[model samples]
Target: MRIATTILVMLATTLPAAAAGQAADHRVLPFTPSGQGDPQAVVCRAPQKLENAEGYGPEICLRNGIWILLTQDAKDLAADGRSVFKRPLVEEPHGNGPAEAVTCRKPPTITASRTWRGPVVCLENRVWASLYERGLTVTGDGRLVSTRMSGPATDPTGMPVIQTTPPPRDAPVIGGYYSPL
Candidate 1:
């Protein structure tokens, strides 16, 4: 009973001290109403209207360093939503040879995987990309090879067409015979 009492006493004493130490050690970052980071610092300027925001929006007051970061983030977010064709050409084509050589009826998906996301358009180079997609074609074994190809395509509810002999990788592309695979 004495040993149990001693352990309980020790725990009771240590718990409050540990909690106090934790509270004191906490490093709280100062967020002042004034544009300046320091709480004691005087307000340098009034809050400015957010220019990038459409229609009327709330004004925000932040330090110069914070403002620059927010502006850059806004610009990047805007560019991300736009199609690759609309933007300047920076990324190289997925396949060999010039991207210009590959004729496209509609804009290519322009992503990591051609059959991953976005609209799948017929390209001279990657004709198989349009094929093997969900609505267009399934494998001979009745497996979904690609599910991401979407747009004006073949009947999704139509009967499955099986290919007995699949063509080689170097076979002539289907959509347009611009060049040999």
Candidate 2:
């Protein structure tokens, strides 16, 4: 009986250890969404669910840094009670270079609107309007100035779209892939 008891105790202790060893052997191998194996690789994670959605929405691959920015933006949007249509106001310096140097142009519909009270620069074929001209407006004079406290960036769901870590440069695109600029 004493031998049997000692055997039972030893079995209880070693059984789990043996089982764990076996489990570790079958551990999930690290692989990118592209099916490439890299132990040190940062694979894109799942995007955040908005407004208590049941599902995770979709599996999109984005850089971890971008994900961080998006997450912060989402949190800020939530706190500001602003609509997703509104974008956060970021301060930008007045360009001393030619107006044509700016690649993008503000849409005419936005510029023609009555609410558009900001400085509107009319390019040859494009109209450039400063969207960040919310709240208190001040001339930079080549210096940074504080702008309005606009809401944070948000997705259509009025929440920040959380993204996962970025994959290797050579990883093939799978599902919804976002390329960082």
Return the lDDT, model 2, position 71.
30
lDDT of 2 by residue, 9-83 (tens): 343344334444344333231211221234333334233344644643322332223223333232111111121
The alpha-carbon deviation from the true structure for residue 10 of candidate 2, after best TM-score superposition, in angstroms, is 60
Q: Which residue runs of candidate 2 sit more than 4 Å off their true CA positions?
A: 1-45, 63-181
Q: What is the overall TM-score of model 2 with all chains considered together?
A: 0.17
Work out candidate 1's RMSD over C-alphas.
22.6
Clashes of each: 0, 1
lDDT of 2 at 56: 38
What shift in Å separates residue 177 of candidate 2 from its native position after superposition?
66
Q: lDDT score, residue 113, model 1?
A: 39
Tell me how far the alpha carbon of residue 104 in candidate 2 is from the true structure, in angstroms, after superposition: 19
Q: What lDDT score belongs to each candidate, Candidate 1 first?
A: 0.30, 0.32
